[model samples]
Target: MKKEKTIETINPTTGKSLHHYSYMSDEAVKKAISKCHKAFETWKEISPKDRAKIILSIGKELIKSKEELAQLMTDEMGKTLEQSRQEVDLCVAICNYTAKIGPKELKTEDREMVNDNKGRITYAPIGVVYGIQPWNYPSYQVVRYSIASLMAGNGVLLKHASNVTGSGKLLEQIYQKTDIPDGLFTVLVINHDQSDTVITNKLVRGVTLTGSPDAGKNIGQKASAALKKSVLELGSNDAYLVFEDADINLAVKACVKGRIYNNGETCIAAKRFIVVEKVYDEFRDKFVEAMSNVKTGNPNIKSTQLGPIAREDLRNELHQQVVESVKKGAKIACGGKIPNGNGFFYPATVLENVKPGQPAYEDELFGPVASLIKAKNNKDAMRIANDSRFGLGGGIFSKNEEAAFEIAEKYFDTGMVFINSFGLADPAMPFGGVKESGYGREHGGFGLKEFVNIKSVMYR
Candidate 1:
């Protein structure tokens, strides 16, 4: 008999183990894929209206267990209880939005054809969809892909980050409570090798992932080699531009939240700050002061504004980035050192005089560290914002809303843009990125179509 491998889920708040899950064996993984393929056969036969009904019921189940799910997320990951609750709320909202619009989005349409022929276009379900999600916003990331695939009449297979295995299982339990068919959604506790096997399986017709760009590339290549469709939501060092006419106070507040939200582990979190020369000094001072004052402690506490990094290695990696950036001429404005504590704690940090050659300027510093760059003017600031290989999401703070909108629409080379605020994903809006941030989109009405086949039938 082969020895079973186990994954220990550790709580970042206390650096303690919360749970242990035995990894699924290769045989079990293959069985799960077979089960998902079986479920998809039935799921695809269901009407879109019926699928929407089940999806809406899943939303209600999520709301019923919001508090418990939120606690699980906080215990497994380092997000605050408030933020975890918000993540569950967002998942519920995604379910609700997809339920409302999915039927219409999947309905067959009659189209005009040439030569006196009538044509009908139909959205048909593909086979099973495989998703590889990360630990940050555990619930949201899983739901962001699963719900849309479900509504589109496809089965879902989730390979959640090992750190959040319990959260992933809880999500599966919640789905089971709904009227969803058995095996419709399965969470496989498997390793990277198993994931590669699943991706290459003929049963999995499509793939979607939310993770680093490097991971995206590997998965994209695997899916491409298999002749499968994929949608990737990858990483970015998102920048926020502070124009000369921008409101400094609002910008400071938004940037603070943007930089540290989710312990600064979010793909779209603001990492780079480009402030015009007219407001650089004042903006830098206030931003550094606010970031320095942020309280990092137990995520469960209501007063805690920041929390520890999700793991010790992640904390160490962030510090290395700060140290290397400083060695390359970036100056530490505040909070550069690691705090003495039991957990993986790094104080909220800000780096000034950031230049192109520094890691703080060139790479995604996946932690609560902000890189401040000065621009000569609005145009220069915009140039600096678009200088990165990543184009996931960005912001522009300007007094004139019209001007900001124009720039966001015409020039901001990002998937999503915030005019005067630092916001996270919205269910009503298309979310994804261009360039190295990965291709394809999720949310709004676009995601339901990502895994569906748009077929056309013509008849005289």
Candidate 2:
């Protein structure tokens, strides 16, 4: 008999293993997919309103276990307990919002065809949707796609990041407590090879992933080969522009929040700060001072602003990016050194003199690191912001709301733009990107239709 491989979840704050899960066997994976598809057969036939009711009850289950799940998330991924709670809050909101709007969003529409014929457009569920989510904001990441898919009448499958396997399992448990049928939301504790096999499974219909561009490419290719639709929310080196007419205080505060939120591991968080020359000096000094004040410690503590890097290898990779950027002419304004510690902790860092060739300017530093770039003027700032392969999200700060909106609408080429404040995903807004950041929209009712088949029914 062969020994089964296992995936271990670690406590990023203590550098200790928290839990381990055995990888599902190929037979088990196949069975799970078949079971989910079997459930989808009945799930799809249920009315959207009935599906929404079941989906909304999942929120109640989540709230019941909010504290335990939040602790599990913090212990696994090193986000502060407060942030972990907030993640759960967002998940709950997702369930509530999905339930509120899903029936209407999925409602059949009537249209008039040529020659006075009647046409009906139906949004039908495809089948099982496989979601590959990241560790940061573990709960929200899982719920963001899962709830919408559930409301759309598709069975949900999750291959969550191995580092946060515990959170994924907990979510499965929560879903089981709901009235949803068994296997409707299955968590596959499997390795990369098994995941690929699952993607090619005939029972699986569509795929969605929130990971790096490289990972997206691999998964997207596999899905394409299988003739399955995929939604990839890839990486981004998002910029927050500080224009000449911006409020220096407001910009600095929001920029710091944008850079360090989720310990700066967020795909959409501001990684680059593009400031006009008129206010570069002031913004840099203030931003660095505020970031320097951020304390890195145990995520269980409420006052801690930044946590560990979620894994030691991730911390090392982030440090290497910082070192290479420095060697390439970017200067560390504050907090560049890797501290001697028990956990995978990296300090909140800001890089100045950031140029195009440096990693600080070129790559997505997936930790609490900030890149400060100076632009000649407001127009130059917009140009600098759009100068990236990533177009997920960006921010523009100006006291003039109309001008800021104009810049975001017309000039910022990303999928989402923040006018003044920094925020993560909202349940009501469309979230996704263009170019290398991946395509297809999630949230804001857009996600409900992502995996649905829009069929046109005509009557003569």
Candidate 3:
């Protein structure tokens, strides 16, 4: 449980220290795990109504601290202050949404009994749940999985992203101050050493991770070795498909937001654009123009539309991807270069004629770069979109909603589809994907069910 002796959180926009967090020692890990094990039984027995009340109270606390949370997220992630506020709002909304909806959602489903004297099927907690959350969408990611799991009578043991360590501690503090039962929600700061053992421990029953494929592969393998359930949301290289019938103005508008939201760090972001041959040039031009129009500067300003990258390494990697794409014959339609600044600033970028070997088509560039690839027709567009290992979220834009739906259905690799729209998600809808994007849903009732153990008590 030895944590990082010193983990610094720097403002990606300023290259300055915002704060520092200490990692957990092995002794601390054992303590937290012990607490979680000690707390699970009581937490499991707590009525759903009481859990909901506590969740609502936590939600209210988050709302009250909205300004502070927003500022913190902005400083750590380099999202615009405006977007940061929205993230806080979304976090509050998700908490409230879970509080209000969790009871109904987690309510045991009545199953037909085979035997007259025995019982039927029901859902129950699987004991102490481990949540290894990501840095992007810090609040929502933790709450999305942990909150639902908590409502399902499972206590949570969280290992949030190292970069957002403060965010994790702050959340734990909020819950602790609310008098939420201890061990019900604990954020242990274990470093790389304990990562492998973190799941194998006997007290921990389940593990959920939102991270890279390589990380997911290792965790999934270890979790599987222990015969525990592992929910791996390994993310994706989300493809954006545009039919010729799409509204150029509308497509361009969404492209701007979709590829730049969260500094284009969203897992299901439209990293690749597949355009129908008929309107390829027109769509490319509009996309470039819209990208050029995005305002990039200080993240704290209300007027700023785009912000700096969340980390220097992320900025550098994104820059390298764009460079490689261009080198492979993709025409740099717009951006493709970082703005002159000390901050980790990569401007909104759009590239056209994105070759098959380029990152636009092959890799998931987690930044503000959009790659445009041309297709002869809808069939060809679908072919290009599905020609990748990742498949999380994608969209089809056409004036005809039916046609858009058809195209979305035609996409073989993706999980969620947006008809005549970008991959903007809702809390009430199921969000996940197929292929290398990983399995498991992250929203709606499906997300809640991810935390529950469906059991059948049949009497014969």
TM-score of each: 0.98, 0.99, 0.95
* Residue pairs with backbone overlap in model 3: 1-25, 1-26, 2-25, 2-26, 3-23, 3-24, 115-459
Choose 1 or 3, whichever is better by TM-score.
1
Ranking by lDDT: 1, 2, 3
Candidate 2 C-alpha error for residue 295, in Å: 1.3
> How well is each residue in 404-458 modelled by candidate 3, as lDDT tens digits?
6766676456888777667565777887777777778877767777867788766
- Range of the 10 consecutive residues with the lowest summed lDDT in candidate 2: 1-10
Residue lDDT tens for model 2, 186-291: 9999888889998999889999999999999999999999999999999999999998889999999999989889989999999999999999999988999999
Model 1 clashing residue pairs (backbone): none
Clashing pairs in 2: none
lDDT of each: 0.94, 0.93, 0.81
Off by over 4 Å in 2: 1-4
Please state every model's RMSD to the true fold in angstroms: 1.4, 1.3, 2.0
> Which is better, 1 or 3, measured by lDDT?
1
